[model samples]
Target: MRSPARRAPRDADSLWRWATLSPALLLMAALGLLPVLNLFVLGFFDVRWTDGGSSWSFVGTRHYAALPGDPLFRASILNTTLFALGAVAGQMLLGFALALLCHKATRGRVFWRAVFVLPVLIPGIVIGAMWKLLLNPEFGAIAQVFEMVELEPVDWLGEASTALLAVIMVDIWHWTPFCFLLFLAGLESLPRDVYEAARVDGARGWQELRYITLPLMWPTIVVTFVFRLVLAFKVFDEVYLLTGGGPGTATEVVAFTIYQRFFTEDRAGYGSAMAVAVIFLIFLMLAAAAAARRRVQS
Candidate 1:
């Protein structure tokens, strides 16, 4: 809409902005985008490594074409979904409860906070190993406790029926602390005047929480839910250490399936296809979350 003289400065400014951003743009292309592009190319090939020989031959969507009918992949999808649902819900509810309790405690605040957050500080593999020992059926304390109920011993991670549930429990135990920390932060950062006004108006516990606490904390709740859901979808280390996706692929998550295809089965193209599909699913979830977040903000 502007004349040449006016438009020149604006165009120059735009160019200068892009010039400043060029380094970051290039870095992202190199680090983030290039790998994805490579993955897409790999997904169309018959890639192989056998007898110390490696080769790549163009096959054109064969791997991806087979994904829908693959039973193991289908089972992995179901298991991953169930794990996400169970783990995220358990973590969010339990974490909110812990956070609320921590928020109300006036004494030993630091000690209680530290105690709850310690599990999150530990590495995933380490936590998996720790729980593995604790669930060791024969001599572990958990098994011993079950023995007191005359149940003999329960091989928590070894059974097909219980393997996924066991891993989900471990995930809930490890991640609930993270949710607690965030919820506690959100709770404390809330304005104090809201409560004072509510109290002055004769509002009691349930009413205050229903009108004030829940409404205010809804944003944090959404954020925690999305983050935990994403993490739970990618669960592998604990399942690997505890169940190895076994009693025959019972606890097989998408990530583990990708691993098997890539390494053990040496189906590089198929693995790449699987990875691409999983990445697409994650992309959709993140996009939805972003839209919801913008709506919440608006």
Candidate 2:
């Protein structure tokens, strides 16, 4: 049996470790949790800014009640859902394909990785601006390409039908590299012996990928999907920079709608409600994904 005296130094060391980590833990709680708690509380209030001061009146779910009846909010919710689904789907498919290609490459893997990751390093705002210019129907690179190809120049961001799709494409371009990096890392970390055994059994490329690779990589795929879905749901920069929710609220996502409510309309409480609703919706989506993963595993 270990003596109490011997355990004293270990306990002291454990306390010292916690003491060292306390500051960081407190900082994280303050930085991450405080704002969320504040937002949640603010969602139930009617905050009005007076002369040099702000006043809060308890509204008690009025903002949440209004959400279902607000036409703009409904539109924004639809647009946000569409954007998230489209962006996540495209990103996952393209990223996984790129990962597979890079993983199987015999040479130039570093170069390909750098090329793929370049878009991810660029700021989202920059990507929005760059795509805005490229998709311009008048005197843009895409316009020039259209002219050269004897095709009509399409105003992707100007048209209501194409605006959301354009932003989704831009988001896919920007974030696919993130998925690629994750999937590639997942692929590399997979046990090589499994592949060796599959090869010895004369498993073809498609068969190995179908039977061995996908099953092994399911968790990674789920994680990437959920992470990207959350990010996609929170998309604001592309709509803000590229379309500004123009062409009649075509690209008005939840985040941009919240931004407009808080800053433009000065409706802080209602905006907070929308923000809280979005968080709840994201939680539901994550829960659904988790349930799906559990079913698959079972």
Candidate 3:
């Protein structure tokens, strides 16, 4: 129990902290939460623009009901899921590998870090455009390499078979550095004393990494995966710039599909329904991952 005088200053300090934070909280609620809530509610309505203004009719869950039967929606959902899984896995593997190498290197760590991080710093649009050129069938670096080997040049973005794969690869390249940064931080922060003890106990490189580094880095890895998973689900720029969700809906993703529905087709209700569903799906995935992690830890 504290004296009233001491309690008064503590309360004042607490109030001051909250007072500083309140504005940002309110702003977030207004900018983020309100729009999501509006979208959720809008999904239950048939929204239309009339000559006079706008109209909304309560249609219940028709938009959501249509999702299962809509071929485009089905394709988009599948593509988004595949994109998220593939990109996350690739990023994690390559990033962790790079981090391990960088951690062990006795020289040029800073230079390698700078080079690897450049891709992440580049804008998504720029990456898409750059990769688009690089993957070109004619005159691109890939084409040049193929020509050197007497192999056929691939029109990566123009073919249905390779469009999704190309975009996924580009995404992996663009985002791997983020995972690398997180992983490197995690690796460097690991206890040196623990490693020394492990060595004394006769642990070698692979044994130490397998039994120690991985277990300790698990949290950071999980966090990075979740962040990348969420972002990958929202992928649009690469698909838009590189493939335009084509050579025949091959690279179509949820975010791009939503943009088309809402902006191009003016199907606001259906688009809102799609957005809400994706949001729900992402939440479910994160929850599932968290539960699995907890179970693994226990």
TM-score of every candidate: 0.91, 0.93, 0.94
| Candidate 3: clashing pairs of residues | none
Give lDDT per model, in order. Answer: 0.91, 0.94, 0.93
Q: Cα lDDT for residue 134, model 2?
A: 90
Candidate 3 lands at a TM-score of 0.94
Root-mean-square deviation per candidate = 2.8, 1.9, 1.8
* Among all candidates shown, the one with the greatest TM-score: 3
lDDT of 3 by residue, 1-298 (tens): 9999989999999999999999999998899899999999999998898897879999999999999999998999999999999999999999999999999999999999999999999997888779988999999999999999999999988888988898899999999999999999999999999999999999998999999999999999889989999999998888899888898989999999999999999889999999999999999999998998899899
List the candidate 1 regions with Cα displacement exceeding 4 Å. Answer: 1-18, 50-53, 291-298
Query: Local error of candidate 1 at 28, Å?
Result: 2.5
So what's the TM-score on candidate 2? 0.93
Q: Quote the positional error of residue 291 for candidate 3 in Å.
A: 0.9
Residue 138 of model 2 has an lDDT of 96
- lDDT, candidate 2, 1-298, per-residue tens: 9999999999999999999999999999899888888999999999999999999999998999999999999999999999999999999999999999999999999999999999999987778778878988998898999999999999999999998899999899999999999999999999999999999999989999999999999999999999999999988888999989988999999999999999999999999999988988999999999999999999
The worst-scoring run of ten residues by lDDT in candidate 3 lies at 124-133
In the range 1-298, model 1's lDDT, one tens digit per residue, is 7899999999999999999999999998899988888888899999877789989899998889999999999999999999999999999999999998999999999999999999899997888789999989899989999889888788888888888898999999999998999999999999999999999999988998899998999999999989888888898888888888997878999999999998899888999999999989988998999899899889
How do the candidates rank by lDDT, highest first? 2, 3, 1
Off by over 4 Å in 2: 1-16
